[model samples]
Target chain A: MAGSDCLAANDWICGEYVRSRSQELTDATLQHLWITGASVAIGLLLAFPLALVARRWRPAAGPVLGFTTVLYTVPSLAMYSLLLPVFGVSAAVVVTGLVLYSLTILVRNILAGLEAVPEDAREAARGMGYGPLRLLFGVELPLALPAVMAGLRIATVSAVSLTTVGAIVGYGGLGNLIYEGMNSLFKAQVLTASAICVVLAIAADLLLLGVQRLLTPWTRGRTNARAARRIRIRARKAAV
Target chain B: MGAVSGAWTWLATGAHWAGGDGVWHRLGEHLYLTVVCLAISCAIALPLGLLLGHLGRGGALAINISNAGRAVPTFAVLVLLVLSPLGRYGQWPTIIALVLFAIPPLLTNAYVGMREVDRDVVESARGMGMTGGQLLARVELPLAFPLIMTGVRTAAVQVVATATLAALPGGGGLGRLITAGFNRYDTAQVVAGALLVAVLALLVEGAFVALSRLTDPLRHRRRARRQSVNSRGLPKRWVTE
Candidate 1:
């Protein structure tokens, strides 16, 4: 214990940190990605259908949104602690916690996205004899893609950050590095982990932004210009 | 079923209900951490956000910086600060880290609120011979109040939750119950502690909602505001509520 503690002191260099912590870093990063990715995928699957139900039945919207909102407000630490007994310290518990957090954003964006779809497009599709399922899949979903993608970007980045909190549950990704580093007073390990997490988050966010742009061509440059114009126009018009 | 019953038993223990390490002490510590950090964060973020919104020049920068700030994990920041020279200063590291985490939402919401104020309304106020101060105080600030309150509510709720991390830094907070539970493998204690945190967070959220309602008469006005529906049944506005 004395020997390990001594080794941690004043050791903020790159080489020493890599030599001792490489395996820990690799394991953490992978676990973190797996936990986050799996949770988000699950969340999307659940949230999309729930969003549809809410949209279809106006009464369902209040309860669904309220439930998810309550879930969202729960502290992540408390949430992990709550699940501690039920799922133990496994990745399953951590993923479930992250999934609950993701639902609110995903559902809100999906509903907003679906609702944002143009009436003309829907009418035109119906005029062309498209069925309800066909219209939802082919016309509505595609138009709502941009907003949904934006929500995904937020959820993914947030999950990445929150996964670190999972360290308490023993499923922390780069978070484990941080926890270990702080407890041991190892400056190098802590610095490296933080740097990595930041870089990873930024890279993920930029990549998603690029993906959103690629997926939504019609919304390019035009949406912001249109929004501004609409706001300006609204100033002149009285409330309907 | 037994898990909840166990949690109840843990809470019912007289020993657990009193003493230096009691739930009340932990709750006080939790609230202190949340309130102090939130106050500091608001002091910095609110003024800066409101200023930027008034100028409408550097708001994009504020938003981008905050986004980048949010991208960095709060745990990582807390850990780094705890190991640095700052950690020796008794809760400074934890407070600073929490402040950083709280800033993004505060800054973004305030700026967004301010910017979202109708430009024509500002112009009309100006035409009515209102000074810069009067225009801001009388027109812009009032209009931006709802969004700003939304930001405060969001920041407060998040801070209440994240403040539990204060325990990991060898600081005092309600998280001690969970940490101690994990160490002892006491599931009941952990559940109770978690319940306390969740309840505290919800309480804070509820308080904020009431605050928003009381303060932002805009809520009523906005409700009366007619929402335009497009050809598709969807709202023309981005958000409904």
Candidate 2:
């Protein structure tokens, strides 16, 4: 039943479409990557300072967290619309909206990471004459790497997902193809574009997870060491 | 400022709130789609999550599934479904896509919540000759209630937001207003449509927050105890426990 004219047959998995439109797919994928990267990177930069400010001041914490949470509650479509007046109908609107959405996850994760740094670590660093900045960067940040990395992974994946919403404004990378394909009922284009988007998000998540493991080597050993200690304790108890 | 005022004027117009293609109709459609999708998602996710969690099996698989689900864009799913054989079925593509989108949060939270219930509590319940079903319904369900509510809230809010995409496929919803506005180059109508969606989402979130507080078993127990104590004319100090 398979035909030589897959594209004309409206087949969902046509290699002909891929071969014919490889350059277009590449452009869309690159745009998607660029948008996701810029939005997430900007989000992290903004979230770090906001997290620091929230951590430093007792009262500011509530409003800072609350505002970001409110932003997150706003629908993606509404968020872009709200930003549209300021940024006009451009990629800037999408990027700004994404940055706002990422703030809630990023700020909360960063703050949690900072708070989880043991009080004794801070005390010990102070005793060793470490400055506040040095302690924050050297001791606390290293300890908080896992949580921060987790946040980064989440934000990046979500950004990749959300970047599709940008297609509404004609700026969505692969999303452009998906939207156009949907309009014309182009089965191959819709399926291929969506598959690529899914792959992009998964790849980004896996890459970030690998980076987290590499950067937080201590986290890997900590779990193993704890498990080993537990086994040794059980053995000792049995022997006695 | 002019655009803001323009949107305000568009919202204030009585004509925009009526008719077959009006704000009210679209709102109703959006809410209906959201509710149906959420109900379907809950029905599927909760039982599966509870069973897996109770059995202490396949939890990692469920969580991983959810994480992968999150990576799939709801918009792409919608478009893909509409382009497929499912397109002719009328609303099935949208409903199925939405259900898929809403399932991840519900399943993840339910599974995680069930797993997080105190192991000691479960063991003690079992010691008391509780059957598996009884243990799950009475002991585990109460403990996991808060987390399950959190999942529901997340799913509900997300479904509401994403349901707006239904309009893109010529389905009726508030998103239609936005799309229609875009076609007409009416910035005010687009903004108005966006505002309605955002407000509806926030309202859904608030409603769930209030609902969870009202229905929380732990909170209900505390309130019941206080009410009984007051009815018995006990001293206030004795109510501390």
Candidate 3:
């Protein structure tokens, strides 16, 4: 119960640990963020082309989707281990695994988004003399923003969670702290590190949500109109 | 390739598959943990999802809570639980963490599936004087079966993957093989352990897919419709996380 003895007592929530190890915590958190960001970015890059290929060739869609789904089914530990031989004991192992795991969600969403573009919209773009590349970039992708962003958010959060598994290779960021803390039974370090991971995931999700809202103004407009119509209908019923 | 061959040799060793710390024992532990955690998650999540979904209320709250739950890493939860008083209770900490990890997909998918049941169908069933229970069991549940099964598949696979973490905390599972391998710097052992976990996860996923297809109440009708629609290739929505 001594104020300064929280560390000695191995309390679950010791401020002393955080105060003393602020630099270590910060470094871990930054690494976590960096890994999550890099993986999601690379996933998007790879998924975009694959999604495009799947969209362009009906015959290829089944295999592309099937392969990614299979990749996703591999356990994270196994994923890293499988890549370990190639990437060795480095951050690349974690990043490669995460990128592979992310493909299932990213590719599905991207393809879904592209497919959802109203046929008439594409027709109009075509009529306007837009080339295939121009049509995809100018009209189809913009319309597909919401679904793509949704995928990004999910993939980002998943990456954050999966990144901790990278701790097995000493590249798990905060996961390393949690792993070490758990092994030594260091209550404060485990709790604090875990809490930070939860926070990072939530913050990343919120940031992506904000980005989605900003990028897809038309989606917001449609929702607003739907809400306004509901309100108006309720008011008419009240009068009756 | 050498590493893979090494792993293959490790797996092929008859000695490694016997005794206390052998592959069979670890696999049993892994399956036990996966099954127990999944059963607990389904029991807790499915009924709540069904009730809320049937009422057409509070589903958003349930789904949001589960979604938020997804943000918390399973490893962190496992470590924290094991470090707490629950640690003294043996596998309780691991079970608790895994059950928590498995619930979100089950809950969300169930709720969404039930809610997605056609409103007109529900109204028609109500008009036919089917009681609430009858309607839920006969109509709504059948319609929602695929989504619910999808959730189960998702949760099952996730639980299998995560149960590996239990071995890190001195609990029992195939994860122990990986952690032990790491300690000894035996790359082949780690690879072998990883291969086992991956195979188990894939097998669980495949089992659920087969089970869902076989047991689907509307399988005949669905197959007929699918055949007619086969010219268009797979549906865009076929892939889900």
Among the numbered candidates, top DockQ falls to: 3
Which pairs in model 3 have colliding backbones? none
Candidate 2, residue A129: lDDT: 99
lDDT of 3 at A152: 92
Q: B1-241, model 3: which lDDT tens digit per residue?
A: 9889999999999999998889999999999999888999999999989998999888777688766776888888888888888889988998998898888899898999999987877887788798999989988898899999999999999899888877777889898889888899899999999999889988999999999999999788677667665443322223120
How many residue pairs clash (N, CA or C atoms closer than 3 angstroms) in each of the candidate models, in the order given? Answer: 1, 0, 0
For residues A1-240, write the lDDT of model 2, one tens digit per residue.
244499899999999899889999999999999999999999999999999999999899999999998889888877877777787889998889899988999999999999999999999999999999999999999998899989998889989998888888888899999889988999999899999999999999999999888888888899999999999999999999
Q: What TM-score is obtained for chain B in each of the predicted models?
A: 0.90, 0.90, 0.92
| TM-score-sorted candidate list, best first | 3, 2, 1
Query: DockQ values for all predictions?
Result: 0.73, 0.74, 0.76
Model 2, range B53-142, lDDT digits (tens) per residue?
899999788798778877998888888778778989999998998899888889888999999987866886788798999999988897
Badly placed stretches (over 4 Å) of model 1 are: A1-9, A221-240, B217-241
Poorest 10 consecutive residues of model 3 chain B by lDDT?
B232-241
For candidate 1, the chain B TM-score comes to: 0.90
What are the runs in model 2 whose C-alpha is more than 4 Å off? A1-4, A229-240, B220-241
Clash total of candidate 2: 0
> Could you estimate the TM-score for every candidate?
0.90, 0.93, 0.95
- Clash list (residue pairs), candidate 1: A119-B232
Worst 10-residue lDDT window for candidate 2 chain B reads B232-241
lDDT of 1 at B108: 90
